[model samples]
Target: MDATWILRLDAVGDGPRIAVKDCMDVAGTPSTVGCRVIAADALPATLDAPVVETARRQGARIVGKANLVELCRHADGINPWTGTPVNPLDSARVPGGSSSGSAVAVAEDEADIGYGTDTGGSVRVPAACCGLVGLKTTAGRISTQGVFEFSRTLDTVGPLARDVAGAALGMAMLEPGFTIAEPPTGTPPPLARLRLPDVDPALDAAIDDALRTAGLQTTDVRLPQWRSWITAAKDLASAEGYWAHRHLLDRSEHLEDRHAGGIRQGRDFTAAQVLACRRSGRAASAHLNALLDRFSALALPTLAFEPPRIGEVRRGSMTYLTAPFNLAGLPALALPVPRGAGALPASLQLVGAAYTEESLLALGAHVEAALAANRR
Candidate 1:
């Protein structure tokens, strides 16, 4: 298995362990950001990113700086310099990026929680791939300061862990005064079961069966703007990403060609196009809010396809099921639902209204319990 950490060290504090994504400054360590060029040029961070500081203030022992895709760009974890974190479920398969190492660290029990940033599925994709729980807090709900971000507008520090409870702990570390809502005991929360094209049948069956077993009410929702939302997110990300790291071009000699190409994508969009995409993002958020007003949350597969083997993913493929929520700036929870004994698990993504992480996580906990009982 490839190394899951950029820098491993003695535990930093006296509480539950945390594996912070290398893109976030951890103080005293150079934030390698899973890039050789950046690593060579980077200096030790003099202070912790606010997100990382929360964990320290809460008594979390910072155990290691986890690796991620270079520039936090790719959907699959395949960093040539840092090496991809082998998927704990199957070493030959891909661990999703750019939070791959953070996911693997938690999956392998190296840390109680893994802190990662999710712009377009970075946190949830890795959690889905590694069979863990990942929570993408509402954009701006968590601090982005001191973190190297892909899209300044979309990036939010999130947490990945093995279960809902661990995810909550991770959230508490990222968000001061964060509370994990108690599992529902009376009526199950209403779910708007979101269906997009190209979802695997096995995944559909798993989500459907789990919700049914959990006695959760679900109403079908098929948003027509799904494709448009994806486009707007890509354009916005491209525009913002270029601005975030174009300065590294002077050191482009050390940058991977693919990453260099990604940085240049912003140049492809005209100012008019960037402005249009920004407007589209606002529309997407408003549309989603209208739906959220009725349903407790939206449920769907975290990934439309199962975790691909190493080298099997294409750019933009992994984000189809995840990016829209990020575009809408909603909090999303990716919870693993066990399939047949030998089959790989499927991830059930629950997206909630802005700042409704507590409700969403509570619903996840309830569904998790029901699925476990059904498996027994």
Candidate 2:
């Protein structure tokens, strides 16, 4: 595998640093973003994206640009222009994507942390698949200026790493003044679990064992409107995406494969459908916020299945167990669980309230430590 595109290993500042998905502008670097058509026109950005600038100010170096799914269209991490990154834990399986290279770079020890964009689980999905920790901060918690827009409503900048503390360190750099609130000096708030319908049994068991070993209390809660929540996300994203990229789609040949099809479909959405979806989104946000108010955070499987074989994901049979949070603009952390058979990685997502990234990291650190101890 040509790991150069994925690793973006550059020694800048003092030590080495890694670039994020190509969608993010790195001064003077082409933002191909996995599209051959845009590669020629891709210009080196004059100003660093806000997040990138922050990293630089903190002494982090900009390595190379990471690979991503074409136009960041799918979660499966496929890019015809740039070959997909091989999962470090299991090369035969995908390193779940859109932030594909970022996850691989971190997993392969090419960098301490890899910056990534998460719009509908791009960061967390790859983190889960690659057996690393990922944080999808609350929407707008981190600046997105200079990063290519996918769906403005859902896009968020985050980090992928091997553990919670590292993720927290990355978050502190991305979001200035970030500090993980220390847990109260007594018993921590009980953990909350959302029972997802038809979730893989093995995934469920793994989460249970993880929680038990961490000595955290767990409770089963239900969110019956989760399906509706997902639909609203798709609808809103499609409408916004269509508008954002309508011009590119007009010149069909110039559009990238991952984006072309989706953009075309979004362009066809009815005005009424878009309006209804937006309305539903507002309502869902209120409902989810109310539910989250009752617990410290919600927990679920990061993905519905084990990481898929690299080539098999092309068939698009994978389930998206982690996309809802992106739509709701909530914070989510993907923490790796114990490796199952075949040495494949699984993960648990800790969903937190908006602007509560510190709490999420604190909780994730506990779970991460417990999992590490169990492996010993």
Using lDDT as the measure, which candidate wins? 1
lDDT of 2 by residue, 76-154 (tens): 8877667878887877878788899888888888777888998888899899888899999898889989988888888
Q: Give the alpha carbon lDDT tens digit for every residue of 1-376 in model 1.
A: 4479999969855698999999999899999888887888799999999988888888889999998899899889888887888898999999998899999999999999999999999999999999999999998888899999788778988999889988888888877788878766777647899988888988998999888998889999999899999999988999989988888878887888988988887867888988898788889899998999999899999999899988778778898999988888999999999988688999999999999999888888988988888877
In candidate 1, stretches whose alpha carbon ends up further than 4 angstroms from where it belongs are: 183-189
Best by TM-score: 1
Judge candidate 1 at residue 2 and give its lDDT.
47
Worst 10 residues of 2 by lDDT: 3-12
Error of 2 at 32 (Å): 0.8
Candidate 2, residue 3: Cα displacement in angstroms equals: 4.6
Give residue 44's lDDT in candidate 1 (0 to 100). 96
